[model samples]
Target: MSTEKIKAELRTEFGKGAARRIRREHKIPAVVYGHGNEPIHLTLPGHDTMMAIKHGGANALLELDIDGDAQLALTKQVQVDPVRRVLEHVDFVAVKRGEKVTVDVPVVTVGDAAPETLVVTENATVQVEAEATHIPEQFEISVEGAEAGTQFLASQIELPSGTTLLTDAETLVVNVTAAPTAEALEAELEEAEAEAGIEKDEPEAASDEAAEDGDSE
Candidate 1:
C-alpha cells in the first residue's frame, strides 16, 4: 500500500497523566519501534490518524514526519477505549521498502452463491507475507452461482503479486449450504423454546403431548 503522509510530534513526557493530557489536546500517543532501534515516543493528530485507519486498513502506510525527519511505518496495534470510542495509544513498526512482513489480511467474499444456498465463512482472515509497500488489504473470493455443498479452502485463494499465503492450505475459507426454510425455522424455534423452558403454542404442543400418551397407550 502507498504510504499516507501524516505529521507527528515527538513526545517527551511518558505516563498515564501525560497520555491523558495528550488526548485532551486531541493528539494520539504512539511509539515507533523495530529494526533494532530504540522506541520513539510521539504524538499523532487524533482525528487524522483515526480517519486514515478508517480509510486504510490496520496495516496502513504511515509516512510520519517527526521533528523534521521522515520515517516509514505501519500501525501495529491500536488501543481504544471500549466505551468512549477514543484512541488510547498506538504502536507503529518501522519498515523498509522491498522488505517482507507478515500480517493478517481480511477475507472479502464477492458475488453471490447459487440461489437458496448460503455462503458460510469458516475463516474471516488469513495470514500472509508480502512486500511492505504492496501488502493486500483483503482477499476477495467469488462464489457466483455456486451450488450447495461447495467449499473453498485457503489454498484456493489467489494472492496478489509478491504476497505468499502463510495460512495452511487445508484451512477452510467458505462453504455453501442450503438455506433454511420456514419449516426449518419453526423446528429450530421449537427446539430453542424447549431448551429455554418456554411454553410452545397450544395445538402443536398438545399434539406432542398426545404423541407421548399414544406411545404409552
Candidate 2:
C-alpha cells in the first residue's frame, strides 16, 4: 500500500472538552504510540486523514509531519460518531519502515457460485502478517462454479508472497448451501407460528363453551 502523507499539529489541550474543540475545528484528535515510547497526542486534518484511510486502510502507512518532525506510523484504530458520521479519535502505532505487523485484511469475494448454490461467507476478514509499509489493500476469493456443500478453508486461500496467515489453517471461510424452497419457507412459518402460540384453526364449539360460561356468570 502507498503511504499517505499528512501534516498534524502537536496537541496542547487534553480531555473530552479539548477533543470536542478539536472536532469543532474540523480536526481529528489522535495518539501515536508503540515501540515502547510514550504516546504523543496530536490533531490531524479531518478531511485529509479520512480520505487517506478510505484509499488506504486502518493499517495503512502514514508519513506524518508533526511540529516539523517526520514520523512513520500506521493507523491502529479509528473511532467515529455514528449519528454525525464524523471521526472522533484515532490511534496510530509508530513503527519503522521495514517492520512487520499483524493486521486483519478484508476478504473480498469474486465471481458467482453455481446455479442453485448460495455461497455464504463465514469470515469477512482474515488476520495476516506483512510489512507495515506494504500491507495489502484486500484479498479476493473466487467462488466460481462452486457446488452446494462446497467449503473454502483458510488454508485453501492463496496468499500473496511474503504474507503469512495468522489465523488457523483449518478454519472454514466460506460455506456453499442450497437455497431454501417454497415448501421449506411454509414449514418454517408454521413452526414459528406454533412456537409463538398461534393456533392455525380453533373449533367453533370451544368458542361457544366460553360464551355460555360468560352468560351464566
Candidate 3:
C-alpha cells in the first residue's frame, strides 16, 4: 500500500479539555508509537485525516510530515464520537518500508451464488502479514454460481504476492447452503412465535358448547 502524505503538528497539551479545543478547531489529536520510540503526541487536519482513512481502507498507511521530518506510520486505532460522528482521537504505529506488519483484511465476496442457495460468510476478515508498502486492502472471494454444500476454507483463499496468511488454514470462511423452503420458514416462524408466547389467529368467536357439538358432528 502506498503511503499518503499528511502534516502533523507537535502537540504539547494533554487533557480532555485540550482535546476538545483541538477538535473545536477542526483538528484531531493523535499519537504515534512503536519501534521502541517514545510516543509523539500531535494534531492532524481533521478533514484530510478523515479522507485519508476513508480512502485508505482498514489499515491506512501514512507518511507523516512532522516538522519537516518524515515518519512512516500505520493507522492502529481510531476513536470516534458515537453521537456526533466526529473523530475523537487516533493511534498509529511507526513503521518503515519493507517492514512486515500484521493486519486484519476484510473478506469480501464478489458475485452471486447459484439460485436458491444461501451464502454464509463465516469469517468476515482474515489476519495476514505483509510488507508495509504492499498491504492488501481486502480479500475478494468469488462465489459466482456456487452451489449448495460448497464450503470455502481460508487455505483456499488466494493471497497477494508477498503476503503471508496468519489465520489458520483449516478455518471455514464461507459456506453455501440450500435456501429454506416455504414450509420450513413457516415452521420456524411458528416456533419463534410460540416461544415468544404469541397467540396465532383463531376462528371467529364460537362458544365452547357449539365448538364441541361441531366437533362431535
Question: Which number leads on TM-score?
Answer: 3
Task: Please report the TM-score between candidate 2 and the true structure.
Answer: 0.88
- Per-residue lDDT over 75-168 for candidate 2, one digit per residue giving the tens place of the 0 to 100 score: 8898989998878999999988778899998877789999988788899888999988878888888899988999888888788878899999
Task: State how far residue 202 of model 1 sits from its true place (Å).
Answer: 4.8
For each candidate in the order shown, give its overall lDDT on alpha carbons: 0.90, 0.89, 0.93
User: Which rank order by lDDT, best down to worst?
Assistant: 3, 1, 2
| Model 3 lDDT at residue 98 | 87
Q: After TM-score superposition, what is the CA distance of residue 2 in candidate 3 from its true location, in Å?
A: 2.1
Candidate 1 wrongly placed segments (more than 4 Å): 199-217
- When 1 and 2 are scored with TM-score, the better candidate is 2
2 versus 3: better TM-score goes to = 3
Tens digits of per-residue lDDT, candidate 3, 1-217, equal 6678999999999999999999999999999999998999999999999989888888999999999999998998999899988889999999988899999999989899999999999999999999998989899889999999999999999998999999999999999999999999999999999999999766556567678899999
Assess every candidate by TM-score: 0.87, 0.88, 0.91
Ranking by TM-score: 3, 2, 1
Give candidate 3 regions above 4 Å deviation.
Answer: 197-217
Give, for candidate 3, the lowest lDDT window spanning 10 residues: 200-209
